[model samples]
Target chain A: MTTLISVPLGEHAYRIAIGANIRRQLPALLAEYTPLTPKAPALIVSNPRIWRHYGTEVHEALTQAGWQVTPCLLPAGERYKTLRTVEKIYDAALRQRLERGSTLFALGGGVIGDMTGFAAATWLRGIAVVQMPTSLLAMVDAAIGGKTGVNHPQGKNLIGAFHQPRLVVIDPDVLVTLPPREFRAGMAEVIKYGVIWDAQLFDLLSQLPRLDRMAALPAEQLLQILERSCQAKVDVVSKDEREAGLRAILNYGHTIGHALESMGNYRLLNHGEAVAIGMIAAGELAVTLGYWSAEAAAAQRALILKAKLPTTIPAHFDVEGLLALLQHDKKVQAQKVRFILPTAIGHGEIFDQVPTELIRETLHRLQA
Target chain B: MTTLISVPLGEHAYRIAIGANIRRQLPALLAEYTPLTPKAPALIVSNPRIWRHYGTEVHEALTQAGWQVTPCLLPAGERYKTLRTVEKIYDAALRQRLERGSTLFALGGGVIGDMTGFAAATWLRGIAVVQMPTSLLAMVDAAIGGKTGVNHPQGKNLIGAFHQPRLVVIDPDVLVTLPPREFRAGMAEVIKYGVIWDAQLFDLLSQLPRLDRMAALPAEQLLQILERSCQAKVDVVSKDEREAGLRAILNYGHTIGHALESMGNYRLLNHGEAVAIGMIAAGELAVTLGYWSAEAAAAQRALILKAKLPTTIPAHFDVEGLLALLQHDKKVQAQKVRFILPTAIGHGEIFDQVPTELIRETLHRLQA
Candidate 1:
């Protein structure tokens, strides 16, 4: 099924299609920019793990469609998302003679999306980046919106630019190959949408069958869920694309989730898994802050539990180390910790200048 | 003479205010963001040259006005406009605890203006960069319209972001101590505005008194010329904010100018001087292409020659060496070279696919 998602960015709005067998048609979809130039190169950048799976298909598709394709394989890992890696992308693009009209395709997960996006954003002051998301994490979060950026060693998503992709091609069939744990990690964000803004969707998610054993999600069901989540995001980003106010709601569980990711060395736990546990802590805080009734908090707990994500940080992780990392998070403004707390099912409250005492107290309850 | 030079960016129209003692009043003007919090930290990035002159005054003005201040001194040189230098500003902002709503003041010439603007553009995804230009070269070109970015080793400004400054504060009195040679180089761009966009200004320039004793230019007359030149540039940049079409006209002489700067060790000559010579070559190309009448071309040459700028490359420079450098210029869209050529006085054309044979022929003439 081909589902078109249009992010309403005023005059710059374009369509993103999520479906199967879409990789074979990118050359035709991107034909507009090609004839605009006499020679438009296609530079495909991905990691070794992903390239081994889908690289040849991309090469064959673009080559067969009468396009000059240059493939560059980068080593996969979050640690490789640095200035050095971004430089390598530019080096390869330059070597391959990728001109201004040339299209850059980021053909992997979020790291590739971000690295390529940053490279494209800065190359000649900006270029067109076509996102081909090959992972559930990328399809659900990283692939959408114009927020393309890389993680700084100090914090995740620290050094980046808001360079929107010209196209985002998400093939749900690719999720079939994702490990069970990896797929579950991405579900954390999906659940976040239902908890903070869609009670009906939350109820539907609670009723869905076991996710671990599912092979291919029915096209219509997948499209409906993906479209709704994207619409929720689109509505918020359209209102506040730069994360000033409305967009911060998207960081519902990220305050503690980011810290947990850093404390665990970003390798031990995936982002969504950390956010799942962070949501539990937020639920408890919501009740303590008197914004959420126990029943509403329980409803949120049920979603995470049903999704089978971690309810808390791993037993070995350091709470103090995590706290230190949270201090450096970009979300912390005015030198005081900030939290996006769930007020109730389908609602959120951004609490700025929240005291460290409240945060520690919330974390203390999580220890239980 | 607080002339409000309008940067015509429809909704986000900013102004370049040229007057005396303007720097002292910066605090009172920014009531919008400062009231967000008390003791807002600001990072003041300056080069050794400007810091020696007005650094403490600017720093003290902010701090004494109840705003927190931090100073980072970078070495003064055009070569310092690199990613490495931009990183130093980033690291300093981080170290100084510069936060959201905290502003960055760039107090120097075009290099300082460009890098600081880029750092501000990408800091925390974006921030306010206030341009305080100390040189005449920066005042009319670099300080207006929000194009802040840094240079890549591969090419001049190959890697950068299009960030606009919140306010551009031009204190023309600061030029009292500018060296004679540096001042002459600045006139090249000043004259460029006359040649490429303002016929009336061009007529005014030709009728002006002797430029031989440039140091004797009264402050009032100097301010008037700078104001007109800057207004012309701001009008173009504000309309085509990203150099898409109208803004490319601003590169009227920068094609050969940038290549010459890189090939000349970036020390023997100033930027304005190289552009002066580059503008002459472009004038020759325009005439050869029959786009510019010989009388108009000679008139353009007279203005530059009056400022004592070279009409051809120095005998020591090699044609092939410059050609090798030109290939690295960021403006290349494909195998065809893109040169922003002047069609007539006060008129410019953007040729994205300039015939290479024409460029090589132009190169040979410059060598001759």
Candidate 2:
């Protein structure tokens, strides 16, 4: 029994379950909330490819378990995480007549989780949502926190609401079908935990066989990593449900990561891939500012490189475009482009008053 | 100096400044937060009528006090509280290059306050706002609460986020410009507080001269009424920040009130007037259920009539149209039209399971 962890957010606490092939346990999870002020119909939202593979089984499981399940298929892509897509989901919910008491089932990866959680948050003020994460990316990072939203053209997550989910079902078996590239993308966020909080987990990832050949993590290995990652997330959210101070730690690589994401036009590099590159940029600054020894910085760089992740920005990414994207980053998307840099290995500082001269020098380094 | 009462919601905790012309103190208020969080250029959201009256003085006040204030006048009507208007304000904010920390000044009434607060909430995820409520309804009710958003075409407040304003500056001086009928519309909500929490306030309202002429309330009278009203709203919001149970008491006459507002095309009877008539219908129900004596019901009717408020639904109103609109009331927009029927002279209960026959009986009384 790999135990379940709870993120205590005042009255919005939710449980995060970890285990192998826990997909079948979803029905039981839904049953757990049956006595919790019984909701209206449950709307299971996902993409077409996901629907083809696991939709029927999950739908049947929920139905046989006696839930009123209504499945809604959304177009799969980063582009679909917009107000336009939100409108479509809104239309479907209204057309299907899902009321305030209804439950939303977010049953896909990161994009689906964000858009669905936002939809749940905004429709008729708000509704209950249960996260059924299918990908490694969603399982470790996106699924736990109540930060749900879509991207604005100006910047990502520029329009969002803090709507907590009823429960989060993380079944490691779901990650088995992830492709090599996507599998490694998820590792970027996992590595973030090590860089900011756990030095031991950093060593663990440095020792893993290059993830290119591994389709899924071994159940035991997967459970340990997930439980630790979720525990870190729960600890942060518990202290600061609204992301005031302690929550900024979670955005260790996100400032540079978001800029890299927008620079790639939201397609070429996956989320974690961009963050991996961002971690490299932040590490360089850590070395330059004498916060970390050159040897430690080199070791951090070596581990990330060994993971088969690129440590440099792509050659074709426009520097000005990237800078503009950074300017639009919501953290300080205000008057200046602020960056969160590592003070030393296993520690970070959110710096907003840094001189623009240093910022330009770092951007120049990315000009491979 | 009447002491201001602060509602404690921690960081979102704010005080309701209930004095004569709290408007002149606006510059001092801006100074308090400017050193910590500088907001240079401001966007003042108001209606045309309000602009013609007090806009110059407000703009000059902020500008001379070392801030650039731009006024964005919205159409003055309840029907204008839709997403389209909100989107328009968002566009204006974007065009003005409003930064994340820039404050949106809600300057007209409840409709303006709700829409402006929502724009601030959604623009760049969230921004600060200060309520400069002009109407009696807004000063006592809408301006103080953190609830802010626009109405969806399907229903009122269907699309909104919980965005608390940084300040609420109540200037009873602005009431002098209000139309006779509009003034009474606000008193309906005032009476709401008295009926739900303080019967002493209710007795005081009955003693005030009929609300025919527009004038500044006596400084002492203004302080007490605004103070009591703020306390009533704050108590409800503090107990149930998310409108779970006790907060429902605040909607005493709003269920059928919304129906009446929609039936009259939002132009005929203002929100307060519809609520005025709705309270009478609830009073009739009190009579039906033995919760209200005939004397209490008549006294309530007499008080509203003295205020020159609407006591019955108009003859021109189609009963079916009223019922159809009732289907979209924010409280019961989805699950079969919830009503806050009066149980007694000093109390009411939120009834969600009431049958259609009772509604029809009440609608017929409105017709009669």
Candidate 3:
């Protein structure tokens, strides 16, 4: 069954299609939204591992649909997400002679989606990008939003653009190859959606027998996870396309999460794992500040632990270092670090007045 | 007195302030449109030469207006206008802790404006940018349009984004130190506005005693040149912000102009000189195809000569080589080289059916 969610962003609005084994339907799906010019050049940007497993199927689908396809593969990892790596995509695009009317298909996980989307955003001063996210994290979160970027040496996603994709194709079947750790990391963001915007989603996840890996969940439950998480994101992003206001709620765990990812040099913890720990810290802060109940915060931590995601900061992580990085965050305004804190299970709000001392105490409590 | 031209792009609308010695009014002008946060961080991205000339004045003006200013100087010239140089701006922005509320002030020629605007467009998914154009080309043309980008090795402006500046401050007084050749190069684009949009602008240049340097013209004539050229740009760009339709007319001489600029490796001929030759070649093609009058074509060439700009393709330039580069242009749609051809002195339209053989003939006949 195909579930379509529309992101109403005026002229920039697009639909997200979630289903099982829908990779072959890419061309037809894209044509429904944007008419495909026959024989027009399209570049498929993916990493080596994802490309090895799924590239041929997608390339064949587009080729059958009359797109002149070229595969550009990059080394797979968060470490490789930089402008230098994005330049490789630009090189392949130039070689393929991709023009304003051409499209770029980002056919991997979040890292690939971001770099490819950013390349599409800036190439010829903007072009079209179709997201075909392979990993769970990407399907539910990264691929749905128009946020595309690469990591700066100083921070994660410090350099980027808000270029929306023309279409997003999510296939749950691809999660068969995603590692268990990565699957758990994806759950971190899934849990984030529950805590910040969807109380029912949070309760549904709480009732699951297991949330650690793809094999443990039924096909129906998996589909629900993808649909609900994506719906929650669409609800927030559609109202605030550029994160001017309502969108900050989506960053519930990201403020501290991004700093943790950077402190670990993006090699130690994946984005979702860092977010998992970050949500724990934010939950504690919310509870301590009297904005949320201790019972709800405990329920949030229980859900995180059930997913087998990390809830405690690593022992080696320095509280002062994390604090320093927070000041450098893109969300910092007027020398104050802005954070998204949960006030209830189904809602979050922006808070810029959180005291440094209180945050320091929260980090101390969060440390393993 | 400042001549204000408003670019009516809805919420993204901004004004272009053109006047003599108006650099000091930047703070007041920007405040009228977008409220400035007190002590907000602002980075000045410029080249060494232009910095040596007017950087201190702009720095002081912004500082006096309560901006925490940091000057980031890059090496001067087109060769330095690449992703590598833009990285320096990113690094400086990071150092300054520039957040979403921060601003990047582009205070140089087109190269500086383009790079700084691209940096602003991508830095933290975009920040505010105020275009403080110090060169004639930038003052009348590049600074007004929000077309920010850096060139790829394969072509010019192959990598970029459509990021509009919050405000544009044009101080023609900065042109006092501009080299004679650079001033003439700026006139080429002014002449383009004539052929493509304003016939009176064309006649005004014809009536001028000389069309060479900044010092040659009275301050009143220079203000008119800046105002009319900018208005022509504002009229076209405000209608088509992304070059989806009517805006392609702005590329009248740019199709061949970009290829020649690339062939010269962006060194042998500056942008204006190459465009001067491109306009002549385009005019010849229009006359040959009966789309334009031969007398108008001759008059266009005569004006180019009057401005001391090149009307002939250099002897070393190869027609086939130039044709090859044309195929790689960003404007190439469905593998067709789209050209903006003139039907009269003040109007141009898109034509994708221009024969390659005709273009080759035009290029050969125009060779020095």
Best by lDDT: 3
Stretches of candidate 3 off by over 4 Å are none
Give DockQ per model, in order.
Answer: 0.55, 0.40, 0.84
Regions more than 4 Å wrong, model 1: A32-38, A212-220, A315-325, A353-355, B32-39, B210-214, B320-328, B351-359
Considering TM-score, which of the candidate structures 1 and 3 is the better prediction for this target? 3
Score each candidate by Cα lDDT: 0.77, 0.76, 0.90
Model 1 residue pairs with clashes: B146-B164, B196-B346
Model 2, span A154-181: residue lDDT tens:
5577667788888888887767666667
Model 2 DockQ class: acceptable
- Tens-place lDDT per residue, model 1, A278-364, is 888888887877888999878777778766788876767767777777777777676777888887677787888666777777776
Tell me the deviation in Å of residue B261 in model 2: 2.2
Between candidates 2 and 3, name the one with more favorable TM-score: 3
Off by over 4 Å in 2: A33-38, A96-99, A213-216, A318-325, A333-337, B1-3, B30-36, B39-42, B68-75, B89-102, B216-224, B316-330, B333-337, B352-355
- Model 3 CA lDDT for position A248: 89
lDDT of 3 at B363: 95
